[model samples]
Target: MTSGMAEDHRKPPMRDLLADAAFELFEEKGFEQTTVDDIVARAGVGRRSFFRYFPSKEDVVFPDHERCLDDMVAFLKTAADGTDLVEHACEATLLVARMYAERPERSLMRYRHIRDVPALRDHEHIVIRRYEHALAAFLREGFAFRPDGPLHAEIIAAAASAAHNHAVRTWLRNGATTDAVAAARTALASVRAAWGAPPTPAEPDDYVVVITRSRAPLQDVLHHVEHALARIAPADDAE
Candidate 1:
């Protein structure tokens, strides 16, 4: 049997090898000029291996998004009770930022290629929308109590997505020199601040204390007080 260390000495995984080969070809020739055959030939793998990992050439440009989207969904699922849902959504976007930051050079190359290619640019938008939809689905459930829950969920999700893209694009444009994760945190923090749940007051300063005669039954008095508070709530909300 081959030892684990010995296995490590072999070529990179088929998926990665295909991606590396495809990117190299994309850089050497234009994205439109690079063929799957060229990529497989460069990687020394079969054409079947390319199809196994990526559906098409466009998919190769975004090899990591599917995994990142799954991770974003899972991360949102782990939110604790009372966690701010908008903030949670914002945090999920950082997962993508970190994915790109993990391999700055490769990310920068992908960014340039996408910018120059109209087809890839359109495909990238679809990929981005998938991430937004995942966030929106999670937020929609959390915000169900609100009357405008669906609308609020979509707006917050879009805001988070836009903030994340801005931070990442800025980082890539500036040569990826700055802290991408930190930039994402800062951008997403702004979204959280704008849309996160408002703090509930510990105690209302304005309250009417009702004193009932001792002769009255306790349960009846409690019910009356609750009814009075319900009546007052609408007026308080208006103010």
Candidate 2:
């Protein structure tokens, strides 16, 4: 017999089967009353098989989330040089939004179930934190920010993730017909505006040397000129 067959021929990949079965049972009898054994029986699998794939019945509802997070991290890591970090982060966030949006019905069902359950809501928060941590790591590495660098990058990551989460939750609440991708883009725009634009290149010095008056203090005049230049110069020019 083939290794795959020898290892476990009781059913197909137990995770997927259990997930489908769990969703069906949840839909039929509601999430609160469903049990792990019930899901395994519906999937034609054993209790051991179900436990091997998922720790609890609640987990069957969130299939492939770890894979999705891994994919997002991989996508961000492979971003080309010269791509804006914020833009790259936004794209990564969009990738996640698309993953959920791709299976709108399943996503919506999971969202609804999670909102009504305290344990699921807490688990979802943990997942959200993982994504935020991954994005913040990317930002810190990509920008070469100091360990204690300005909280700007971390703040941006939090805002971006929160925005994406809000968009997805709102879409689910609206029956999942709304364009979540567009809503995500709108949310990311708010994050971008919060972060503002990238740094501009320094301009070449072009100030003319002016001779000073004999009666005026040179220090005072120089200070006044410096302040004026600061106010009048473009950020790039000042840089």
| Candidate 2 residue-wise lDDT at 195 | 73
Candidate 2 local lDDT, 86-135, one digit each (tens): 88898789887888888898898788788788888888888789889989
RMSD of 2: 7.1
* Candidate 1 lDDT tens digits, 70-176: 99999999999999898888989999999999889989999999999999999999999999999999999999999999999999999999999999999999999
What TM-score would candidate 1 get against the native?
0.79
Clashing pairs in 2: none
Badly placed stretches (over 4 Å) of model 2 are 1-13, 146-150, 196-239
C-alpha lDDT values of all predictions: 0.89, 0.80
Provide TM-scores for the models: 0.79, 0.75
